[model samples]
Target: MVAKEGYRNGKRALVLLVMTALLLAACTGKEDQGKQEPEANKPKEPVELSIWQTVLNVNEEQFMQEYGSKIKEKFPEVTLRFIPYKGKGSAIQDLIAAGQMPDIIYASVGHIFFGVLDPQLQFDMTELIKKNQFDLTRFDPALIERQKQMANGGVYGLPTSMDTLVLYYNKDIFDKFGLSYPKNGMTWDETYELAKKLNRTEGGVAYRGFGMATGAMFTVNPLSLQSVDPSGDKARFTADEGFKKLFENFSRFYNIPGNEVTQQNITLAKQRELFDKDKVTAMFVNTGAFASSTYKDTMNWDVVSLPSFGETPGVGSQPIPTYFYIANPSKKKDKAFEVISYLTSNEFQQYAAKQGRFTSLNDRSIRSVYGDDIPYFKGKNVKSMFPVKNASPTPLTKYDSVALASLGTQFDQVLIGPKDINTALRDAVEDANKKIETEKGK
Candidate 1:
């Protein structure tokens, strides 16, 4: 009996030992499994990319936020640093000079003109574009060619948004003056006649037929240049009879007696106020300006083709190709290229288009965005404002910048009668050419 009891106790002890061993083995296996994981398996922290933009104005931030935040989410590794142009030109120069440049620089098409002035400062995106099979067909070749004229073969930026100019007229003003609405193919002479009929000084108000932007001559001169070989660099317009006709045509808007319209010291905002107050009957405006005015506000107005100049359709506004540029020699070139590719895609463009009216440089995508029928774009022949046949972008070079600035000043002088049309254009062209020759060191 004693032997039996001892044997039974031994069996019980053996079973307990086996169970404990199994539990210990299981715990050891779990620890070994934990040790086998590689450090790389852990979630990587995102990359933070800084983006600089000009959407800091009070009315602009909301629209910018709609897509700006989406960009941040899409590029988890990127954090956009929205920098506003603080009304200080020196600040931009200083920030850019200090080597603290943002990963992405978003500026106007004008900047691209300046970017090409110095190759070292701008990145050449040719190879990356080829490698990624990025479709350049998405952009207007005319726009692209204009950008290429800035410098060498290196592409410095990609245009994500564009705005073309059109003529905006107040319907009420036309009705009150007993004048028909401006037609799609109306010539400058016709526009002048309409303006003359509409000008009025009554009821404690002086009404002007039209308003002009002093800087607008740079765009207007292109039509005359087109008449003298659009591809040439020389200023044939200075000597061309057609160019004189162009100036005379512009002068009609200002020649009206007792008209309050004067080009000197007038601003876009002031013009808008005039339009709102029914003081100005018509004005030329770009898509950006129009978007800023009509997004949610009620205005009794309509748009039509820019007034024609004889056989040539009136060139209202050129499509300013605002773009994003990556530094070619950037330390983070690969990533920068990726960001650019992503930004200029059709998906992103559609988002921007929905907020404001845009004609895609990519034809197919444009068709997709604006279907075969759109009410606002219907047959007052909206196509007249498109492909701006004579649209000329700013020339790239220090000389071009100086030329444009000098030209703007001179144009203002002509409009205000400080200089005759021929003398002003001649002197301006001579001064500009001299600067150009000096810059080229030829």
Candidate 2:
């Protein structure tokens, strides 16, 4: 009786399997006969790809004109839309709360872990890159390493552009002092010597020798120091010897007699205004002047590579990079990858380079066209923007942003307060770790 029951059950199972196969075959026949349009047509509902980046600090109209329109031209069925953040209210966080993460997200290298990784939205594009046969070698190796540093041996994003540090000098100030313009590949020590010559107060107007808008330059210091250590997952600004070595040397600028950090020029805004609008400062280690400044048209300025250090010959400051990522929750990852891949392509890069935005591509042709279309940059030595080599990218974490912010406070203490360099370094890291812990609680 048991054997008979088993045979009957096996027969029933075979019959059901045959019926299911026949039903699937009939559906396949319908699909072959173009009955799949209903399923396919759902995606035809005006393919809108949302972007959560400023795209070189552009407004909606500007972004649409430059990058958005181009994407529309290629993917005619698609509309590229932006979810702005700069100078806007908490956009990304709101999106996260609403469960509406954008298809493409842009982040500066430092913000990678905070904005993308912490949200658990980082998507490794390695397989997509391989599937698309995208060549990674075209980009500067440092930028590639930066992406890998953000992910654990995975390419989380593709570099779209960079903001490189250079020694921006007021040529008029140099002329006033009878000093020659700084040349490319000058060491920081050489820059310090030049700064000494230019540090003077003539006719009651204080002229600073060397300064920057903020302590941003030191964040990418030539010593290749990073605020946080990935190995230990804590602030490394105090522990790393490189940080002290860099800070010890850089702090000299603040002590250069007339160039001391004062109440008038101590703030970041004042430092930038002094060099840019007031034109009191002679040299500034800052981002390239690519028609970016409102004063660029009026100011007589040129740039050289960010001063290299004696300890690291020919290595420039770490590249300040911005990358494009396809968020993990994005339903249209393929289209997102296609759009971002096109963004990093030769054609788009050329267009971007001409528009005075720095290109991340290692292509000389793109680099040569750095400011071709910008009238203000016609005769400026923009080539000094690219160094012979970029310093190796260091490990980054969510704590990095907090750590860097605290450094500014501790850095101020070094220049003006009674604290020594070592003391300031210790405070910066300690304050940063405390902030990191506070943020962790949130």
lDDT of each: 0.59, 0.81
Q: Give the residue spans of candidate 2 off by over 4 A.
A: 1-46, 54-58, 86-90, 289-295
Tell me how candidate 2 scores on lDDT. Answer: 0.81
Best by TM-score: 2
Model 1's lDDT to the true fold?
Answer: 0.59
- Candidate 2 to truth, TM: 0.85
lDDT of 2 by residue, 1-442 (tens): 9999999999999999999999999989988877555764555446788888733355778777657877887677788778777654545677888766799998777677656887788899999999999999999999999887767788999998888777888998889989999998888889999999988888998888999755777677666777877666578877758778776777898789888986666898888888888889998877663346454677898887878877677788788888999989899999899889999999999988888778989999889988888888878888556788888877776677788888878878788868888888888888888888898788
Q: How far in Å is the alpha carbon of 419 misplaced in model 2?
A: 1.6
Q: Which 10-residue window in model 2 sums to the lowest lDDT?
A: 287-296
Q: Can you list the residue pairs that collide in candidate 1?
A: 47-77, 49-79, 123-327, 123-328
Residue by residue across 122-203, what tens digits does model 1's lDDT show? 6668888899888877787656765575536557777776666566677767776677887765677777777787678667
Model 1 ranges with Cα > 4 A deviation = 1-45, 53-67, 87-92, 96-99, 113-119, 202-204, 220-243, 258-273, 283-288, 293-298, 314-317, 357-360, 364-394, 430-442
